[model samples]
Target chain A: MEAPATNNQIPGELGIWLFVAGDLIVFSVFFILIALGQKENADIFVQSRGKLDLWVGVLNTLLLLTASWFVAIAVERCRTGLGATASRYFSLGILCGVGFVANKSLEWGSKITQGINPATNEFFMYFFVFTGIHLLHVLVGIGVLCLLRSVSRSPGLNERRIRTLESGATFWHLVDLLWVVLFALLYLL
Target chain B: MLPFFYMGVFAWSGTFCYRVSLGTWFAWVMLLIYYVVKAIDRVEQEETASAQGQRYALTSCAGLLRNLAHAFGWENELKEKNVDPLFRKSMVFCAWSGLIAIVLFIIGGVILGEMLPPLLRANDPPEEFVRKVNEHLLSIRIGSVFLMLSFALFGPFGAGIAALTRRAEKSPVFSYVQLVFTSCGTLVAVLVAFTWALMAFRPDVYHPTTVQMFADFAYFLAVFSVPVFGGWCVVIALPILLAEEGQECFPRWVGYVNLWAVLLFAPGQLVLFFKEGPFSWHGIVALWIPFVAFFLWILIMCLSMLKAVKADDQVTGP
Candidate 1:
């Protein structure tokens, strides 16, 4: 109750790392299960996909991929010393994140409205679980990008800070990459 | 697979040190996964000039939260920077301690339950009593989940704290101080709800009625009232922990957000009042100021990661 003796630095990087790692592990389990679950429950999984508006998934992936491209350009600019120019590209990526979230909301809304309940089947379970968690990660990614922008404006943006920024770039790409894999697994495979 | 098999064996091995069985042993495996991801992120930092490498790292979900900012919408002002070994090492130590806490916790759970007198334990033993003996530990069971969850939270939470701390001491950014304050207040509000709402209803064992749960939650919120919400706004709106590591991030005021959260929540520490009041009114009311503020801190952290990603991209670009 007495603030847990945490003075801004008690747990530190390892602490943050553990939290994110644990979360990722949980997500990984889900991802792994989804992939494996599909192998075992093919018919239902396909049926669930049939219910999915693939166009939305495809569009979302394309948009995110493009945004990742912009971010890539932005980071390259940073490497070349065009700080502000790179920031613009980063902004474009952030917009993509917001756009992705919006598209996802639409997808979710339509599905929920259609009465595609979570308890329907293993397929729906995987559908909801996979997309839902991914969406949350994407949302988190969006929030992180926003924070980076504000921090960029401040004096704290230094070389070390740049390294941290680099980490964010990698994480975003990861989100995009994972979704691509997910898309292929769910829609194509 | 072997580990999973071992887990089955270890879970029931409470008589033999449980921490040694799970926490300490598997902890290395878990921690290794952590450090490797970070190491990979550091390597990716070098390849930012390359599109593929940038994609590889960013898409992998491994890296400092700042990397997330670059991937999102923030400006890439903060570049690759280092922290003091003291701070970095301290953070690493925090991770080690967190892991140790987990290990010790399991062992503690085992010891308190199996080794203790029968009077302390419950009359009802669970089905998986052998594998899940900790379920029998009356004292440690109360917070085992909290402890484990908190331990897990350490990695990211610690990193965020360390990053912000360095921003405060070294960076000239001023607005961060105020941001930290707002974040802390939000955390206070969340904690208030969590403590009161979570405590009032022990997840109904039977088919839990949603209305009953909602009623309890609503009652808690009403009892805690708007003063706490106002407190949350004040705490979060302050721009306390605004210090930045570079030119593009945040103001210096953001640095104080978490500090203010700790301050706001300090009132709830008054144990006697919290215990005596109805609905745990005093306890819940006390957390009102700090809970929401803390929520803001978390939000700021996520946002900063995204911003840093953007800034990273900008700096990497030519």
Candidate 2:
């Protein structure tokens, strides 16, 4: 009840954390279910996995990882009062998101052709559900970055500029984190 | 998949999404429930007027007893100056919301059942079908019940309470609770629609071919997350309300209720992950919400009393 913060309180780390929490809970649940179900249909999942070209997942992962790195640098610049520079880097981050989605589309197309219908195999079903849902979030984050770059020219924007970078960075990193857990669970392990 | 340009416009502008495929059978069912509640209100009002003439003070109060049970020791708390009046009112609304949720859930479920394919019923005569029915029926029915209740009771109750909790300066968490609860309510409404869609889309689920059943169930759960993704808002927002009065971060009861949701949901989602051939994941999904919802109802009663106990009696005549 301390006189409420105004509509835009220069949305801080808290905003990013909340977004990450929701995303993480969802992916975790989806992955955990897949893991638990894997035991019930290991052969089905493994065979389904064989059909998937994980090189695309690998490329998507690297793109996201690299994007998060560049985004971090963008946030560091914003902290140092380099707003214009931060804006430029955010555009680059958006590029990374676009790349990941393109690769995903190719990967998805091949699977559909191979008759790996999500409903057919438990593994393939989760594969489509989890990744497809995640791809949507990636696009959302990309859109956020693109939007941030557009109106970032106003004076005295620095105080909250880091937040713009931070939310996008948080989302990108979470995408990477999920892929990491997913890579091991889905591929190597 | 939405195109890049569309995502760009929505993301940059922070679009206001008021989507609910409103022209569905569930929309009609919701209208029916609304009409029934209105009728009940009118008839009850007339009965109250008639009974008042016969008895000096009507004591055949069926609702009154439940109201009393719902009342936490708040009146005494108010007398002793232990809580804030605004907080007390909000808690009182929470109690009413809980009650409305239970009643509406049953009504929604029965109405929804009217639309389902007759083949989904447990009474279908084939033995193989009967075996699948027994395996999946309980979980399916229970999930369906909670799914309906989410619309009828849960979301509206939260939104109603948050609306009542309005503050001139806006309590940060409290103000946010309104949007959160309203979204929760809306998600439930959509899920109720899907129940009819999936069943109607595949009436032969009662006697599905092996490949057909697997695809049907998998596809349903995947799409069904339209609600889960939305429902987590409650999980997120409840902590904000429970964090009031600078107590422990979340309401002690909410942590308990969430734990209940998890306890109920986790195992079922897991079993469902493995359940094949004529099982009811939807039913399993419904069973988790009500028991914990009612349990939270009890907690609100205790909180309301504690709130009343904490009420500041000074300048209270207003």
- The model with the greatest lDDT is 2
Comparing only chain B with the true structure, the TM-scores of all models are: 0.32, 0.40
Q: Poorest 10 consecutive residues of model 2 chain B by lDDT?
A: B17-26
lDDT of 1 by residue, B1-318 (tens): 576556556655655764345434434444444455446445434333343443565446545576777778553444434323454444445444434544443343223322111111111232222222324434334433443343344344434444544453554332344345334533542343343233223333322343233323433442344344334334333333222322323322233333333333333333222322211322222333333333334444444444443443465551
lDDT to native, each model: 0.49, 0.51
Q: In model 2, what is the error at residue A123, expressed in angstroms? A: 2.5
Q: What is the DockQ of candidate 1?
A: 0.04
User: What is model 1's interface RMSD?
Assistant: 11.7
- The alpha-carbon lDDT assigned to residue B202 of candidate 2 equals 35
What are the per-residue Cα lDDT tens digits for candidate 1 across A52-157?
A: 9889989999989998898777666665666666667878899999999999899889988999865577777557656765786698788767766654544534
- Off by more than 4 A, model 1: A1-27, A147-165, B1-20, B27-100, B110-318
Best by TM-score: 2
Give Cα distance to truth, residue A78, candidate 2, Å.
0.7
Models 1 onward score TM values of 0.46, 0.51
Q: For every candidate structure, what is the RMSD over all alpha carbons to the true structure, in angstroms? A: 16.1, 19.2
